[model samples]
Target chain A: NAGLTDVREAVAGSLSAESGVKLSADHVVMVCGAAGGLNITLKALLDPDEEVIVFSPFFVEYLFYSDNHGGKTVIVPTHEDFSLNFNELRKALSPKTKAVIINSPNNPTGVVYSRAMLTELAEVLRQHTSDTGNPVYLISDDPYKKIVFDGVETPNIMELYENSIYITSHSKDLALPGERIGYVAVHPKCADAESLMSGLIFCNRVLGFVNAPALIQRAVKNVQDVSVDAEMYRKKRDFLYGELTRIGYSVVKPQGAFYLFPKSPIKDEVAFVQKLAEKKVLVVPGRGFGSPGYFRISYCVPDKVLEGSIHGFENAFSEAMK
Target chain B: NAGLTDVREAVAGSLSAESGVKLSADHVVMVCGAAGGLNITLKALLDPDEEVIVFSPFFVEYLFYSDNHGGKTVIVPTHEDFSLNFNELRKALSPKTKAVIINSPNNPTGVVYSRAMLTELAEVLRQHTSDTGNPVYLISDDPYKKIVFDGVETPNIMELYENSIYITSHSKDLALPGERIGYVAVHPKCADAESLMSGLIFCNRVLGFVNAPALIQRAVKNVQDVSVDAEMYRKKRDFLYGELTRIGYSVVKPQGAFYLFPKSPIKDEVAFVQKLAEKKVLVVPGRGFGSPGYFRISYCVPDKVLEGSIHGFENAFSEAMK
Candidate 1:
């Protein structure tokens, strides 16, 4: 019942149709949250020592979730500019590689993986599966699917990869992180689709989200089309990015999601976060995201909170420089 | 967040007041569900190989929950009528016993423990604690707390036992089973109360509920005073009990909850369930509830479902006799 509820199926189905693909309810596995979705999918695909290739500076929970299910993480670090690192990715791929996890409108870096990049990634996975004599699933951690600006089309990985699974939630899109509702939809064309569905259901039960909260499953179904105000996030992103850069901090300009990953003026990102705490600006260290020398500022806070912190950031930056 | 949302605490607090216990925010540990609450309490209190005692004909999940946390269940069979067998209980206690699980308006049986029985049981727990080195925790599973019949009082175990942790949920009471919302509350007087709170919170997060579903937490908070109609359950129980008894079945009349456990006319309860199922009347075997020669009929269905099944039950009973 968790995220694979009837309503979630409807949402995923509608979304799939909009992308010009046919999807069925059998493909949907409701989950507790995006974490739940990830855990469930990993549980479905992983055997002991099976490896999942992750693009680093990834959402760190992926490591924990994968380990929880006995899978080893094969980290493929992105480039200096935080773009797709195909060279590193190709090196990471192996016969034991069971999956590759992609977070488009990525967390930490907030770089949306371009269509060409996604297509290439899918091609790699398809080729690797054929070459290795086993399937390597493509998992899209896509909580920020609808949060991108400029009306760019996000690549449907399920469309391009025959062995793709989509994991998403209303946590970011509908701004319901605490609701603990989301879904895992396997591409119907995925190899051994029925086994995947069974594994997902077992994972959902054993991982302890008996089902998603029922009413929210229905409530989210009603609001699947309703989206968060991306303009608000864009403004916050602009303000934070400009302010941090003006203060001589290096950072990737986030393309989607509500976070700015700015390089720390100090060598230790954790210490930098501690110093920001001293300035009463709470931010998470990039070390937690597997990328030191950077820290992330969540832009999801109300404008007033961010506006009030502008002075704090400026003063902290000046003091740190001193 | 699984069930850690403040709103879920508020709802749990409001509902705890139904038993005359005024719960503050600190009292509620929002959970994955009641199962999560029970498992959390066990994890908090039990060390590896610690023992938990339970009366037989208990909920099956108790076995898995206790074992999951390295607690062994010491089973003490109840009286022939499924009431507490005090004599058997007195012999079951050991130094390794960390807790005793009690369910009322009991599952699979629907027998509400009388106030005198609960008082006497509390005394037994107290005496056991005194005889042993540490106080034994009383774990009360009271999902059917609000469902009672003929204006009977279901003694609040928390009121009777100071060292009790009460695990209850809105699933049964509010008919919101899919919501996966519930709470675990430690009595203020429990030993090492603060540590217990920490353990519960730790368990909550470690179990991956992270917190309860947020909207249901808020929804329950809003409708804490509302309850499903117990009168309907009472009527169904009465009708089902009467029909079975009239057909020469020996049954203990259920005083609360939405189930009726009746002695089978045949020795094998499994066969009885199969016979009933043949008549298109589904019922669980008593063996599943830690007893044989008796079967449980969940009367949660509407009156029409019950009334329509009367002739069916009659026919099944007659055929079994033949």
Candidate 2:
């Protein structure tokens, strides 16, 4: 249930090379996807009613995944620029807070947490642990780690936090979400890391993801160094970011991932999204990501589709603002 | 999260053809494997502390799968011949009995449930449901359905039970356990079948499967009618059954799958198993399947290995009896 050893070894090699930290195959558990990894991790770490703190504008599924294993989700709002708000986090941490989930090159928002940001976040967690005598885990969900724009490299969470569990999938990096292959790596230096690894392996089986698809495990074993061209997504991001801003929409310039989380011209993003939909422009309401007054546009579509949406976006923004 | 349309349609076609029941793509939900299907089914059907009945000499994983969804396992023993023991089943039924899981051709015992037996079993469940005004779902786990021996065609539980949910994987039949492809087919006439399907689809995502591996789903769509040749397994079953019986092992002749459940010469099947292992012939103690005084031999090995194990089996049996 841990995973194919060769695949784990390949992953370990890549993770070590990228982070400059030594990792062995024993640290990894193969999973169906980031989703599977998160579920198993929560199953292993959570007891009844334990709190898992997730930053606002988070992937919505984090709530469900935490709840699946009897963990309650405590949503803490990020800063206006979607950076870590350590003051809010400090107030949120409690003895019941078992883990904190961070998605870098995050879903919906596309804001990449830098090394400085992660280090500060790690310090907050360490301080909480020292004060409460309760260790809080940092779960880094990094499916979009390789999909960054502007030559930005997502920081390795393992290097910044000893009590970190790094989870990632080839979904965005390899553009293979449908293949359902990923791994969860426990930081070997974490408190009771060996016991945590055992719990992960046990949950992997009992949770019914016996192992990742064997075909993909073998297929990706040799391709650990390979990834989809982020430049292509970057091009799409540039066009959409530029067009949306030109059309009077206020959007944060995304650093990574193929999403533009633009403030709605109106306060109610769902109403604004409906207006966009009426103009034949579709986007997810920011409320779906636990943020209001904004909507998320995915720019991963074909060039023609992105180009075509320009007029619709302009009309929707003009009408909503009016 | 339900699954690829074409794949679900293909499975529906095969299930309809095999069961002589009209089924639509809507009735099917693709899952990671039989294991995934069972977890989701239990998740959808169970309330906390509800009971799930399993026939002992059962797949050991069923306990974990049931508990994964807050359902407790209530194991009712089978008859001496390993058929459904209705009297025991009747006594085991309660208002809290949410589901009963049956595997046939069985796992450890390899005893296929005849249609007459299933119809009778269905009747008992129906009676209990009517008495308590609570629906008792029949979950048929059929990974070994196509691996029957001696011209035995496994009966379709869906046709016999209106509230049945049929779950099977290509693991044993297509030799694709590593690929982890499977589907769950809800009986069209099942109580609240539509709601149950929605619950299943919801559980599919919340439980972290999202969907079965998409690559294998497409790969197996065209091969639903294809299965590994049963005669190959039948031959191996015959060889092992014949040899073990000739060596004075009191074994129930298996009718399906690749297992032989034989009575250990000593009441302590674990000790008997150890003696067999000492002789270099490995088998599982029946207590692993919630039955004692017996051991299970899986005969899916090469013929040479089977032949080589005869002396070991003979020595272990003689030593245990002495």
Candidate 3:
């Protein structure tokens, strides 16, 4: 009853094909979600005061996950374009650095890191490990793996970094956020991959997950191929992104996922979000993601809701400008 | 996505009525199962090296649960009848004593602790708390609460102690072990009950459970009032107990749960279990639960299997006696 056998292998097969990252059944650890997978992986890898480097304005939960397992999270601010600032990332690395967690088709900004960026990061990690003898793992979370727009390619990070872990769920892909089902794929070439897999399974139990939900595991296998209407989300993103940029709100074009981050019209994102709330617009302050002076708008809602919120966004922006 | 609103409140109400404990919605925290609830509660309440006292021949997972959260599990041997020895328990308690985890309709022995024993233990705890100024939480895991035979009453430890935390799963009662749905109910009268409830919910998320399975949570509410087939199990228990005792085996008449524990005619219970396995009769050695010279037989299978296995149990017991 720990986990259904076919579903675990099914998840492995599904991920190997979807990710282009070769994996065996032993490599796939089914989890509650990307959140579940990430936390389990972190618990397995981290000791007290161990450093996990995460980019700022990252999914805020990453910090919570690390801290929950006694790992210290080191946050590096991203560039204005929301690309990996490798120079800053390199400066953040040290002997204490245990892993770097990256979310592609990222949550708030929807900025997908290309293969080139990943390969460069891998190279940086390899050099540092060679110099300091402290290996740093690359943990890639891709809940929005299938939600890319404009034909963006999300690199199989495992292919670039031998010490990579691919964590994801079908929450975004299958429109099943409430299900909380996902997996952790340990890279075959990762250092001590077998040991890492064992630790992950042990942590999965001791950390109280015991295993991923049984029914959802079975359900996932049956509907692994069922695709959500990503185009609908794409349409929503395009409309919302256009509206923000059209009114002189500086916002990056989202490459994937269903969220767009725009610079607040005022310096105080909290105050600006409050101003928007007054217009019945609900945007999260960037401070929630450790990046203030910006606001996040999620388009993963009803079309009518998105349509109705347009006026709120415009009104809030105009009022902030005044 | 976090939890079903009604499920937590429903669990609180259900347990309150069943156990005669006073609990509100805030007192109940839904979890994946007793395993999930236990681990989260341990993580919240235990600091490194704190002691959680468990009676020997207890549920084996209790040790693992304590160790998972850096707590030391101190095992106290049970009385010959598998009852709690208050004297031994009193000796086990110290300034470092944090919790006492007990399972009634016990896992291996199936000895349901009476209300009197629970009250005595509660008084011991109250005196210890008064003298040492440290609260000792009584953690009662009641997965088999509804499985008791012969009309035995499973004491609600919350009614016995203010600091009690009841951890349970509906797997046994609802026959839904595969679903992994359960909850933790913080005692309303407990000191820091509010903080404990908050810690439990936080631990549920950060420990990678996120929440109990959403579908199971909903399903539990619908079938919460469904009756368990206690008679079917009682019939199996009676037959199994009769056959073993008739064959000159020393077996206790199990008052609850689906298991029967019989003293091995041989001092080596592990070897006795192995002998039974040789005849294709599966039984677990009590050594696994910290009580050697005994083995646990589960009557959870069909009656046909139980009938067919009678020869194996008799043959093994006779051989061990020789």
Candidate 4:
């Protein structure tokens, strides 16, 4: 009755084991996708004007998702190295802050948060909850959780904090974005976890998702262990990152995910991306992701496509410099 | 980009022609399901505390859908025959009323509204709209439009009224409830039609559906012209109705869809339904649907199952009387 389908439980259990989180099937709420999970969780946790602090360079959809539930999005920029900026994040916390979303193997930047970083962040949240009595939850948004590079492990939020929630999709890991399949797992230790799960189920219905499309749920059930070709993406990311850095662009080496974020030669990343697009190369400006002076190149395409785009990347950056 | 996908437009066109409504692809919004469509449309139309008048014996979810977006649901009781009680509906209308939802070939009661009833209702709306100068849009929820009996015609809502929106799911007609695919169509003549379309598309995205499941959308595209065998359901409805009537149950004959609504033998519809369930026959109590003194039995089942339920219904009815 609580969206306790056997297949949903199967994947939830599999995910629980992998994340080292003690989650029963009752803690799992199947949703349309990670976005659906996030929206519903926000809907459950927020009242009008509640603040949800998000790390900068986050998924742009976070702003809209937070606003949809009548919540304010307080964006705090990460450290210069694209890692957790505890100083600024601590400054951002308030009684009004209902949650802080962490998207590791993070979008745009492609930087994965280390376990130590997450452990400290949880401690900060714990202190805030005790001091303010506001229960500022940590929400882990983990689309690239399974897409880590060079054996970098994504932290399981449930391990770090009793008040954390997880919203993740098989979009990247299982390559099922078009399928719109994901699940929300509440840690057993999450405050009022049972009631929160129920609230999510209610939001799922009221938001009109009703439930995730059933066919994919069945497919996911049978193939819960299988995943997309992560090695292929890793190679592509390496090639793209190596080429851009050799071309004299300042770029952080991505530990996971399929995107390379390189500093634009020009001050305006949007203009730089525009030039790139004109040269038959496509990239999203980092400004759109709340991180200026950098642009994101998705390395999810065939190697040949990446190989062909090398010249465009060179031409666009050189042209932007001129 | 607009959410006007090729397949979405194809089905929208097919539904437009079939329903005798003049609608372009721009008017259609492919949603998660009929419920999804309803929620988004309500989100688009209703402001906080605005009133949405719904008929009694309605789908229980209507209240929740309206309330999800801060709209107040005003339940107007239907006629004793379970048809439109226009007098009550008219009295229920006020400046606060933003819209009215009509679920014809209705759920729970299975009442397929006649064209005359709809024409009069539209006239009532016209008068109200003119008197208050507040455009109260008519929202027709038509899941059972394709499953009508006795050759009753579903009103071409656009022809009956200029200001209307039609939301329906293929779940019933295409036997695809698990598929969770449907669309919302604004009449070409609807006031602020362009804005309404934009509003629906905006609501579709912000509501976290992002879009309907692509797999089912593609499937429905080519199968737009095909529908489940309504005759099969018609036969089942007849069988269920005949058996119940023979057993001295007072029930309304369903014109469409696959349900029988019979007055419970006991005053407490919930207890009566509980008794039926105790006899291994499951039915929804009328109170659940805002329509008490009755219970609903879905006839979308095998003939043998209906045959098998005979003794249980008889036993449950007799026990309820005692």
Candidate 5:
């Protein structure tokens, strides 16, 4: 338990320092999982009927998390091909909007916003905060921070927004989802730093997580520098992406994270997912992520499974076309 | 993942069994922790400005939990010796009351409510619910159920109140708190059972527990009948209780659980707690628990530590009297 806390603190500290960010030890609230981190943050930040802005094709749980706390989620859906849509985001902003969530190398779509996009988003956020006189916090849900494939690099949000709070976990990076441990690091320079820290600590305790699991907190702290073998996931992503494109399926190549968000060969995603399940392919429908006609395929399975599913993918495509 | 779902279902099944009580499994909802259960219950059942009655010397977090969700807590102070005060409870209730929290084998003050008292309390709850139109939920937080001493039996809240929901964990019972595993078992007989379960499931997911730790859920299933060595706590409780009493400190003999709520040999509890800390004994002040002029000593530590603290307690008592 001791070791895990040390490792987590060290990693969080190193990350904050490397980005020239500032946060006291108290601002770092460790949790059971990134999912826990998300829940805790929402619990602390949201009050009834307040709004949190999430980009489109976002994780479905974001909607649930926000709604549970009586917060409305304003979705600024990304461009049709799944890139950041700043024009749409500007339209989504309002005085009641409490926060904006950015997931880079994100879930489903797997698009990484360039630094230029982030710089512009920050400028817009600053202007919005000034205009509304209500600061809109940035929640960077970056569980896939280090799961990049090829040569893609994801920028840290703390560098872009002083009010940013980063939530990440080792579920993907260390393959420790079963372990359920992670932390929330708030940049010390954020507005109302003390209130923010207290809200987070109170949220952590009141939300039913007094602290992270003592033993796993120490375990992750011990193996802070160590990471999961993502090579296997990278290989699975490559194999599936290759086979789907070959079979005439349209997909945006996964830049990072172990998921493929491929446009359905047919326009109806729910029906497409049902047909795929018939072929024993258990992909989650993208309609759940707020986008129809696209579906998410998790590539976290083994290499042999991906290789074996190639023929199944081809068959699903043929049946759909006919 | 499979084990977690099974454990959840098992907990659900436990709630549904005909305990010969009025409630069925419909009342039970799996939660992140008892804390999560408390907040969700408060959120679901409470309307703005509604009152929640809590027995004083209750868990301090109860106040924070209730307030955060928009309910006000009406504290009914316990008797001089920290036993139930039924008259006070009768006076405290109003039509706006949402629920009452009863922690038997109570924390800080380890006085277990007698069966007679519990039955009387049940009658109070039933009458209040009938008269109010809004059913008053009885939330029994039971992390210390198996941590009692002697031949005492902890009364089942489900047996007493048809509207009761029990939240418990292996944390204290199995000494697995760092594991963050627990359940919320609602009696299915509660009013609006289906909606309650739906709210609970949403609360569990939205609160960020997603589900309990999958592996620990499996591990706990194997140890349902296993318990922490009660004799160890019994011995320590006896030693500390005896030593404090002999040293001129008055205390209610603990019937269950591992805490000794000793009356401050002196009246100033904050000062007393600070002085004890000076002597390297860490006891929370009674003021923290909504009762002054008394403080708590956690007897959960090893016997050797309790033995070593005997002289410390003696010296502290002597110094306080001066």
Candidate 6:
């Protein structure tokens, strides 16, 4: 139930090498995917009506996953640049707070939280724990950890906090989302880490996942260090970023992942998305991610498709501005 | 997500051929396994505090699976020969009863329900559904459907009842438990079948499964008719059954699967199990399956191991009788 030992050992070695923290196979539990990892982690940590905190412009499914285990979601807004807003997070921390989920290189927004930022966040959580006499768990969802552009490194949450759980998947890195394979790494120094691991293993079965798919577990063990070339995504990102910005659409440069979240020319992003769809260009409304007045464009398509959408993007932006 | 279209079509065709019912891809929902199928089905059918009926000497996980979806389990005892007891089932039905789960060729007992028996059970459920104005779903868990012995055929529940859901996994028949792949087939004639299927698909994602693993789904699509050799399991069953009964253990002649549930020599089956363990023979106490005074022996091991355990079985039986 914890997982196949050799697969867990390989993941432990890989995470340890990247995080500079000593980890063992005993701390790792294989899961269906990042979705599966989050579900099991929440199930292990939550009692009824306990709260979980998430930054605004978050993965929409985070709300559903928390609710699945009877945990309420508390949304805290990030800064304009999608950086951690510590004031908001500090206010969001209450005795009912069981966990805080951080995703970087984030989904929808593509902003990667820096090490200095994480250290400050950890300090705030530590102070809250001491003040309230309740432990706050940091859950880092890192499916895009290997898809970062430039030389930016995703700092491991385990090294940043004592009571943290690190989860990741092969979906974005290996481009195997349909395969549904991932793992959860519990910090060795986590509060009640042993019991948490046992609970995760127990929930994995009772929740009907049983274990991660066996064929993928065997297939991915040897390829732990391999990932799809980020340059391809980088090229696609550059093309869409350049085209959308040149077309007079206000956009922030994405550091990682394959998304570009740009402010909508109009206040209602959903209306703008419908206009773009009429022009044969598709993008998700930011309201879907809990932030309105903005929209998300996924740049993981072929070059021809991205190039072809340029005309539609230009027409939609010009019409919206007019 | 519903799943890959081609895979669903393949499964639909295979089920149609086997059950002689006209099924389409729209009626099928791919799942992680039989466990995944059951969870989604129960989640879709159950409201809070509703009841799901199961037979005694059942798979232990049925209780947890039912409770996972806010449903309570009401166990109906089977007859002395491990057949369906209609009187207990009739007495157990209530306005709160939302579903009835049947597993055949059953676990622990390996008792396969004949087509005539299933017809009678369906009639009883239909009468109950009419008596109380609430629909009762029949969920057939058929992981061991293809493992029947002595040329006995297992009836498909979809053909037997209008409000039936048929779930099967490649885990047992294809001998691929670790692969974690299966599908749920909702009878097209089921009450509100379209809405039920939509709920199942929604629950499949929200429950953290998302979909069945991609590799196995693709692989099994072409081999739906293939299964492990039931004769091999039959040989092992024969060896264990012949030897145990010859040594004065009262055992049932199994018609399917690979289990033998025998009356324990002593009234306390747990103590009998411990004695057997001391003699290097291991069998599960019947209390684990909601039945007592009998123990279960699984004969799916290699022939050499079955042969080697005979002496232990003999010694344990003699000591218990003395």
- Please identify which of the two predictions, 4 or 5, would achieve the higher lDDT against the true structure: 4
Over 4 Å off, model 1: A2-9, A18-21, A42-55, A63-76, A84-100, A123-135, A202-208, B1-23, B39-55, B63-76, B85-100, B119-136, B202-207, B222-226
**Clash list (residue pairs), candidate 3:** A32-A180, B32-B180
Q: Is candidate 5 or candidate 6 better by TM-score?
A: 6
> How well does candidate 6 reproduce the true complex, by DockQ?
0.72
TM-score of 5: 0.88
Which model scores highest in lDDT?
Answer: 6
lDDT of 2 by residue, B70-94 (tens): 7899999988989899999999998
lDDT of 4: 0.85
Q: In candidate 5 chain A, what residue range of length 10 has the lowest lDDT sum?
A: A1-10
Residue A86 shift from truth in candidate 3, angstroms: 1.6
Better of 3 and 4 by TM-score: 3
- Candidates ranked by lDDT, best first? 6, 2, 3, 4, 1, 5
Taking every candidate in turn, the Cα RMSD to the unseen true structure, in Å, is 3.6, 1.0, 2.3, 2.4, 3.6, 1.2
Which ranking of candidates, highest TM-score first? Answer: 2, 6, 3, 4, 5, 1
Give per-residue lDDT, candidate 5, residue A120: 87
Residues B27-98 of candidate 3: C-alpha lDDT, one tens digit per residue: 888787888899889998999899999998887878878876789999998888889998899899999999
lDDT of 6 by residue, A124-168 (tens): 999999998889999999999999888887789888899999999
The per-prediction tally of clashing pairs is 16, 0, 2, 0, 18, 0
Which portions of model 4 miss their true places by more than 4 Å? A1-4, B1-4, B319-322
Worst 10-residue lDDT window, candidate 6 chain A: A243-252
Off by over 4 Å in 2: none
For candidate 3, the TM-score is 0.94
TM-score of 4: 0.93
Please, what are the lDDT tens digits per residue for candidate 6 over residues B125-145? 999989888888999998999
Residue A288's lDDT within candidate 2 is 88
iRMSD per prediction, in order: 2.7, 0.9, 1.9, 1.4, 2.2, 1.1
